[model samples]
Target: MLLFLLSCFSFIIVFKSSNLYEMVSFLTPKFWIQLFLRPVLKNHASFELSKLDDFEMSLLDLHDLALDQILEQLSPAELCSLAGVCTYLRSKCRSNDMWEKHMEKKWGRIIGNAALREWHWYMANNNKRKYSISGGNNGGSFYSICSWWPLNLVFRPKLQRKSEIKGDLPPDSIMAWYLSLETGEFWFPAQVYNRENGHDGFMLSCYDAKISYNLKTDTFQARYSPHGRRTIEENISWSRLRTPPIDTPPYNLHISDCLDDLRPGDHFEIQWRRNKAYPYGWWYGVIGHLESCSVNEDHCICHDSETVIMEFNQYAPESRWRRKKVSRKDHREEGNEADGFYGGIRKLYSKQEISMWKSLWPTKVLN
Candidate 1:
C-alpha cells in the first residue's frame, strides 16, 4: 500500500501531472477498500496493470459526460467517497437520474405502488411547506399549493423561483428521497412476513404495516393497526418485507380471477381474519390435490371444478388449520366468524416470491 501511494506520487514527478495524484489522494480509505481490495480479492481474476503512456491522460481530461459514465460504475458508497473529492464531482455524484437506479435496485422489492404514492405525497407535502407561493393573495388560489387538489378556474401563474430547500435532504433530488427512506423520515405502507414481531401465531403469515427504517440497528420498525390484539412491531430485518403482489388494501377483499386456473402444487397467498372487525392478513399456502383426483396431471381436472382445496403444510397433519376448501364461483369471504373468514386470493406467479416464502420456512411444524 505504501509503495502504491508512492508510485501514485511518482506520476506527478515523472509527468508533472497533478490531476491523477490529486484524484487518488482525495479518495477515502473506505473507497479504496471497497472499490479495489474487496472486489479484486474476491473475484481472484488476474488483471494486468496498464502503463500510462501520456502524462496528460487524467480523469480531469475526460469529457463531463464521459466522466459521468465512468463514475456511474461506482456503488453508492463509492459514489459518496467520489463526491467528497470536490464540488464539481459532488454535483455529478448527486445526480437524480444516477441515484434513481440505485434506489430502485435496493428498495423495489419491498416497496410497492402504495409506498410510491406515500413517497410522492411526502415529497409534495414537503415541497409545499418549503416553497412559498408569491401569489398568496390571488383569490385564495394559493390554497391549492397546500392541498394539491386540482386547480379549477384559477390560473396557476408561473411559480416564482426560491432558494433550494435548505438541508442535506433536498426534495428535488432522488438521492434525498433515498436518504429520507434510509433515515426513516418517510414511513411507507408494505407487508411484513411473520408480522407482529415474529409471534409464533403469525408464522408463515404476512400482515399490513406502516414501515420505517431503523438505521441504528440496520433493521426496520413496523406499525400495525390496533386490531386482532396485536399492534406495534420492531426490529424487522430486510428479509421479512415484500412489496404486495397486488395493491389491495387490508380491509377490502382481493378479487380473484385465477381460481379456475388453480392446480395442485401451485403456490398462493390468501387473506384471512378471525372476524369482520379485524383486518385480513395474508397466509401462505399451496393448492392441494382433491381426495378423489389422481396424482397425474394428464387425468387431472381440478381446475375445471368449482371448488379449490388449499393446504397449509406448516401445520401438523391432524390440525384443523391444515386444510381449507373455498368455492370458486361463490368465493367471497367464505367462513363463519368461528372458523375465520377467507378473503381474496392472489396467485404466486413469480419464482422470487415463492423462493422468498420458502426461505422463511419454519424449522418445526406448527400445531
Candidate 2:
C-alpha cells in the first residue's frame, strides 16, 4: 500500500510541472515577462548596490602634475571639452602657462617680442573685447604678424575701378608689394613676367619702404627713400626700365602723436580704400621696433635723426599671393577660405561673403 501511494504522488508532481510548462509556452513573451519576470527584477533592483571602486580615477582625483601631463597630451579642443566637464578642469585649462605653451607651439618661431606682448594682451582681454577694427565689407582687419619674415600685399584691380576704366587698367593698377625686414624695405614683388606669350607668369622682385610706428598713437608713418621711390619706376614692368639701388640712408619720422600703448609683436595691417567708399583688400605688415623720440616743444615734432622710426618692416607673403590655384568651386565652400584669395578678388559683398572673410581670420588657438 505504501509503494502504491508514493508512485501516485510522483505522478501528480510530474503532471503539475508539465501543465506549467504548457501554460508558459502558450503565453506571449510580453505576458510571460509581466507575470513571471517583472517581480524578480523589481525585487533585485530594490537592493542598493555599491559602485565599483576599480574604475579609472576622476580627473580631479589625480595629482596636479599628473593632471597637467594628461592635459598636455590633449589637443586644444579636447582641453576645452574637458574644461566644460567641470569647474576644476576649467581652471586648470586656463592656466597662463598652458596658453603660453600653446602660443609658443603655434607662433613662437615666427613672432617677435612685440608680438608676444600683444599676445599677452590678447589673452588677458580677448574674452572682454574683440581685438578687431570694423569698417566696410572688406575692412582692414589686423592679424598677429609673424616677425621673422615680411608680409606680402597683393593689390588686385578693384571691381568698381575695373568697371569704371572699361577694363583699360594700367599694369600698376594691380600691384604686388612686399614688406621685407632683412632689407628694411617696402616695395613691389620682384616678379618678372614672360611677355613672349600673352599668358601671365610670376617672377621674384625685391623692394621695401622706410616704415615707422608710433607706439603712443598706434599709427604707422611711411615715406619712400629717394632711392626707394626711384626703384618703383624701375620695378614697374610696364615701364620697361631697370634702375640702380637706392643708397640714401633711412630717415626718421615722428609718430609719437599717433600711437597709444604700442608694444612689440603687435601686428598692424592697412587696406587702401578706393576713395572712402570701397576698401579693396588688406596690406599686412609688422611693427619691428620702437624708440623714444625727443619731442621738439617748439614744433611738437620729433627731431631725433638717429632714432629708428618704428620699422614697419614686412614679414610673410599674403595668402592670396601664393602660387596655388584656387578653384571657383573651392571658393563656394563655407569655411576659412571665405576671406581667402579667391580668383584674385578680396572685397565680398553679401553677409555670406563677409562671414566668409571673418571665418578666415578666426583666432585658432589649436594646431
Candidate 3:
C-alpha cells in the first residue's frame, strides 16, 4: 500500500510542472513578464525569491541594475571604455549635452574668440604682450607691444624735410622722425638735423635707437646707434652694432647686407618671379632661431622653422609698411624645413585674404 501511494505522488508532481510550462508558452511575452518578472526585478529582495520560482527573473534584475549609478561620473577615458564594453552606452556617450558639459566644466571661462582657439600649442615660450593706445585726439591708434615681458616705453619723433623737395614745408609735410625714451610721447616738433639724408640718396647716422616697428620687413629690430661717423653703405660699422648682416645683395648695398640681422618684427621687399612678372613681394622679418645651417655654394643657409610669419603685406593700405623688431637670444634653434619654412608659408597664406580685406576697409560696416 505504501509503495503504491509514493508512486502516485511522484506522478502528480511531474504532471503539474508540465502543465505550468505549457501555460507559460501559450501566454504572450509581455503578459508573462507582467505576471512574473516586473515586480521581482524592481525589488531585489523579491528577485532572489523569484529566482527560485522563475527562470527569467534574474536576467530582468540585472538589466535594471545596469541602468543605475555607474553612468553618472563618466570621464572621457571612461566613456571610451564604455564604448568598448557595449553599444547602448556608446550612443549615450555621444550625446551633445554631455560633450558641452565636458567642455564647460572641465575647461576655464572663455576669454575671447582667439582665446577659445587652441593657440597654446602653436605659441613659443618667449614672452609676448598685446597693447592698444587710444584717446588723445583724432582716432589714431598706437600699437601695442607683443612680447612676454612688461614694458613702459614712450615714443619721441624727430622729423626732417626730404632733401629733393625744396619749398616751404607744406602743412602736411611729414619729415624724418625719431623716438625718445626720455619722454613717453611720439613727437615731431623739430627737424631731424643728423647727417643721414631724409630722401633722394641713402644716408646713415649713429644714435641710440629702438625700432618701434618695421613695416617693410615686418620685424622689431632695435640698436644703439652710437655718436660716431659712418657712411650709409661705406662705414656701416657692423661690429659696433649688436647685429651685423652675414650676406650682402646689390639692393641692400647702402645698408648692412645681413640677412642674419633679422629680428622679430622687421620687414623687407623681395623680387619674386610670380605670374611671369618680377613682382615686388613683401616678407615680414622673422628670425626663427637659426635651428641649423649648412654651407651650400659658400653660403650658410639658416632657417626660422618655428617662427610665425604674419600675413605678407605689400603696400597694405592699413599700415604703410609691415615689418620686424629685434630681441636677443644666444642659442639657435635646429632646422627642419618641413616643420618651419612650410609652416610659416602656410600660416601666411591661410589668413592672407582676411588680412588684406581688413586693410582695404578698416572701418567698413560688416554685413
> Which predicted model would earn the best TM-score?
1
Whole-model alpha-carbon lDDT for candidate 1: 0.70
**TM-score per candidate, chains pooled:** 0.71, 0.25, 0.17
- In candidate 3, what residue range of length 10 has the lowest lDDT sum? 147-156
Better of 1 and 2 by TM-score: 1
Residue 178 error, candidate 1, Å: 0.7
**Model 2, range 266-325, lDDT digits (tens) per residue?**
333222222222212232222333234234345323222222222222212343332221
Query: What would the per-residue lDDT of candidate 3 be over residues 125-154, giving only the tens digit for each residue?
Result: 212421111111221221111110111000
Candidate 1 local lDDT, 6-104, one digit each (tens):
854654474344343343433423333344446565555564322111122434455777677667776765565444334455567678867988898
Count of clashing pairs, candidate 1 = 0
> Backbone collision count in every prediction?
0, 31, 54
The weakest ten consecutive residues by lDDT in model 2 span 146-155
List the global CA lDDT of all models. 0.70, 0.29, 0.27
Ordering by TM-score: 1, 2, 3
